[model samples]
Target: MTILGSHFVDFDTARILVADDDPILREFAAVHLATPTLEVEVAEDGVFALERLQQGGIDIALIDLDMPRMDGFELIERIRWDDQLKHLPIVVVTGREDMVAVDKAFAMGATSFVVKPLNWRLLSHQLAYVLRNAQAESSVRSRLHDLQRVSDLKDRVLRLSRQKLTGPLNDILDSAQTIEHLSTIPEISASLRRIAEASVALTRVHADMGEAERLTPAP
Candidate 1:
């Protein structure tokens, strides 16, 4: 299906979990939400939903506020607390007048909310929007982490390059000094002097690199 401002969404590869105690609502969601590219899995209650989620492969979750065994509120809390499931996008599906439940769902980290008497025609589009936005957010976070890693590596390389050059530069300077001391000829002494000056300049460059490395913040 097409999402606004983007290419066609490949729902087929998406695995959606519908958690509700009502059989009719579960069937309705499965029929309306399913597509050629998408697979919808139904859970009779929050406990079953948690079990399936723990088994993994759930890309998104549609949770009902009222259910037997665990209920959606508690399930959302458990999911948020679990490291593996904490990042999963959750959409709370509830009654239109359930404002209290809605607020609690958001506070518990529900990605979004949907009101029922299910909008059969709009369900797919709405879900697509939520999934797209969640995916975009995840992509941005991943890119930021990659950029940080690259920046850190660059800083480390700069530090290592300076360290590797320091000893060799000191040895070059020492050799230049020895040559200048042993050679009494004016031309030879002048050449050694130039060599020593060049070595000192290179050493200063290395020192500048060290200072820059220190100033650069760690990622």
Candidate 2:
């Protein structure tokens, strides 16, 4: 990870897509977004952008609102609907100040908005923020999934232990109880005490495992 301004950017594995009809704007975005660790790919239109996205490994998309063939809004909607691309962060770039357009872009699932005649430096920071936040969210989801798997495995183990060990443990407890009742000799009584204590310990362990199973959160 490399520090850009106040934010840490792990751009070594980050791939960005810049989609715009204008060659100059696309080049400007590509250049500004690119770093030694980051790779930026440009698309002439939404169609090309969608194609590149389909190919995968695009961490974020910088898209122009107005373009020929497929517009940004349509592209955004399509991307949002796609299972693979739904979680992808998209920042819409537009010259229009119209609230309706902005609202529509957001409604269609644009992660952020950037006005054209771009501030290259600020744009870089904004993109970094979006990427970082997305990455963080993704990390959280992955960790949650791993935790859930562990919880599930614990539950399964608890169930199996109870199923397999319960009968034998009960037998041990029953035998200890019988020995306690029948034993009269001092040595036999002492053995009974040890057996009772061991039985109690095993029962506590079984109960604790059951409690852990109950406490384990559902996926």
List the global CA lDDT of all models: 0.88, 0.86
Could you say which candidate leads in TM-score? Answer: 1
Could you tell me which 10 consecutive residues in candidate 2 have the lowest summed lDDT? 1-10
lDDT for model 1, please. 0.88
Candidate 2: segments with Cα more than 4 A from true spot: 1-13, 68-70, 81-84, 176-186, 189-193
What digit string (tens of lDDT, one per residue) describes model 2 on residues 15-39? 8899999999878877777776678
> In model 1, what is the error at residue 104, expressed in angstroms?
1.5
Considering summed lDDT, which 10 consecutive residues are worst modelled in model 1?
Answer: 3-12
Q: Model 1 over residues 17-68: C-alpha lDDT tens digits? A: 9999999989988877787777899999999999999999998999999999
RMSD of 1: 3.5
